[model samples]
Target: MMEEDDDVTQGVLLRCLSLYSRGGGCKVGATTSDEFGEIVGKSYKPVCGAQDTSVDCFSYGVEKFRKKNNKKKNFQLQEPNHNNNEMHVFLPDDILEMCLMRLPLTSLMNSRLVCKKWRSLTTTTRFMQMRRDGYYPSPWLFLFGTVKDGFCSRDIHAFDVSFNKWHKIEAEVLKGRFSFSVTSVHDNIYLVGGCSILGKMDRNSSKTHRGVLVFSPMTKSWHKVASMKHARSKPVLGVYKVNSNHLTIKSQHNNFFRTRQRIGGVSDVYEDPHRLSVRRVSRTSFEDQKSKQSKVNKSVKDCRRFLIIAAGGFGSWDEPLDSCEIYDSSSNKWTEIQQLPVDFGVVCSAVVCNGIFYVYSESNKLAAYDIGLGYWARVQTTPPPPQVHEYTPRLVSCDDRQLFMVSVSWCEGDGEIGRRNKAVRKLWELDFEYLTWNEVCVHPDAPMDWNSVFVADKNLIFGVEMFKIFGQVLEFLTMCDVSDPKMNWVHVSKNQVAREMDVSSCVMKSMAVVHL
Candidate 1:
């Protein structure tokens, strides 16, 4: 009887394996011994058991096969017995990795604690590359907020696109910082040019620094890189590829300069279009001299890959600056570039696409800077929708080699002729070749007050809204797939932490999307 029971359990286990191996096409009762052998590529004998019985051999082991009656016997699977060595089944590492890759990111992180092998397997660079290449995980949206205390909160929230869930990330490095610009390069988040306040009680100790902080979602750690030469606050930041041949100092000259003369007791170089010009100092400051000398002396030490471009921001004296700088990853140095056109009001939004740096100013004017030619051009496209505020328009680059602009406008209420009652949001695509703008779609269901919006993987668009209700601030996330013709906006859930904490005094700072 014991031997019969063991034979029945073994046959059931083999049948379960055959079902998985055949992708669930093999029927239990219909699969004869010869057919089962062909499915598993192994010879096995069929034991007498109930035809309707099913077992999940992957999760739980077979303890015993019970006999129910004289004519018909029922087979049952029970909890795994650790002491029963004969029932243990081992899968190949490759198969185990395939299963692990299918799990959600949060579950995959928890799976690392299962055993040393799993922990090691998931941490491997090859495994991460494989999972990323396979597109098993969706891009994650990261949201940052600042409280009334003038400091960024340490607790950041990330939204999982695949599971529509929120996960808390404790970014202790961002604590006590404010006014920093956040951007991502190659899936790594960069916090650049912010003021660091040391003591909560002492507001006079606030100091602006040029430090750059990098946060890696994969390792969940923070590290500092070489600081910029000139400290800036809320600077325009973007990434562009710098060609080796374009590194000559002559290219840094004012190509748009029509004439150079003294204006208002300061040397200035004037441009023809829009009367845009940059002020040139008669006597250079120490930093200005060093910048000029570096421009002349600095040689291309290695093949340049990509550069981090930082432009127009408030300088240390609380005055608006038109100076620009670029950070070369190959040399870990920040070199001064051509200054932004004078009187180009505060840079509200910036993006890099097709080797060009595009900046939208507070005056509702769009300008493009060609990295290769080392010059700037005012983009004279169709005017944006009426009354679109500077911060309301967001520039996003898509996978189709297209530039998209998202902006929000206020519409008058139906009851009142002039009173604005509703907010309307629309998307526009840019024809880069012809320098034209075309309307794409209108998102009617999006939140009226969107604090931040960003694109992920060049295909998905995420919009984040935060508002105070019942003295508690809650964050809501919504997403839309740009590839779809409908471009329907799907609402993700509100943040779980926001529900628990009273963040009414907090305001959204920035948002980034990363794949982990």
Candidate 2:
């Protein structure tokens, strides 16, 4: 209710901001003139504000103006054609932004198209960083519906946690009759191998090839990169930062020690980028992917470039895989990892946290594959996550070592639309490092009959709900802090802000923290 009250309050103030500019004044009868300013001021103070003196002086002016003309008047209407400069009231940018802050995130994001001033505010990295930090928001989720006609396309949607609205982005680079395998590392989308279903001119269509396509909302363009070894399907693209050492060459005159510091983590993925190997038969023997094919790529005394893994997403629904493979960029090859036990099977939904990988079984069980130990052990499932609705679980993301997944029980569950989710919606968490799982439940009943879930940071999960097997209609996202037992699971934005999501270009494969 307080949030709703905030919406009403901001609505009234924004109405005033537009009118406040006109000869007509603003009304504070129901809304406090300084209230909105104070709210937005808090969001910008420490970051966007330059100095205390400037901030203080600007704040005072807005407050003074409010006190002078407290009455509300519509901005669109002229105020008796007054020529007096006395009514020329203006507030500093800092204070005005404070009011804007109070408005819901959806309003704030859409404010970009409102006018030049709003566009400037939305596009600025400083304001964006401030928003991310202050709100502890999650990255956006770009989802695509079903694919057909030998052609596949999905909309790119960003779920802004701060504003709680989903925005649709339409772009040309996403056209193809190909399958999608995507992931979000940083704020970008990595779209991997897909064969075109239709057009003869469709690039990479029909034939399987390994070519990587990437999309970053910040840059808003798709770029191609190296290809993979084989044409793969339903590849679960997991993006993680690889920590490498920062190098510094020292002159012979002075003795230098290896910095061992990292040049910084750049985003890379398990791409099937063998643009050269598309339909070609093996130049070398094709080893079964289920075996542990990872040899010590270089075991060099200096650096061990980390390996990224991909597993069990090939074949048709009836013959889904249990095979897994890892790639070492240093070696430029794919190493098939040890397969899971017959019961555990290959992880249907799993994510890497810190350095450990927590892979969830399709059944009610889960296990951790120790990268260092080279073994996969079965873990117990007490509050067994409700059985995965389909072959895959909703999501798998790690918060430190605490893993979070939104599992569904198909026996029964209804979304807000009064339709039953193929699986009943429920929020579940597990501290994988400790082998402990939280049974406490939260809701906004996920808006999915079948949506790929991605870790949207701690206590939050987001995914796409398809209108059909091929059309995406809605996006489901929610935060369940539950730090206070009293708070069950507050719906951040599902039906409310998600209405603006663009489902057309959603490439069912990618996930973002919050749509930029």
lDDT of 1 by residue, 377-446 (tens): 5676765555447235777777625678778766667677667686677777886434567777777564
lDDT, candidates in the order shown = 0.60, 0.46
TM-score of each: 0.67, 0.53
Candidate 1 displacement at residue 6 in angstroms: 29
Q: Mind giving the per-residue lDDT tens digits that candidate 2 earns over 244-363? A: 443121221221111112125321111111111322454233333212232431342324344555555554322456655555555555555555546775456667764455566556
User: lDDT score, residue 359, model 2?
Assistant: 68
Off by over 4 Å in 1: 1-102, 148-151, 199-205, 241-305, 412-421, 445-451, 499-508
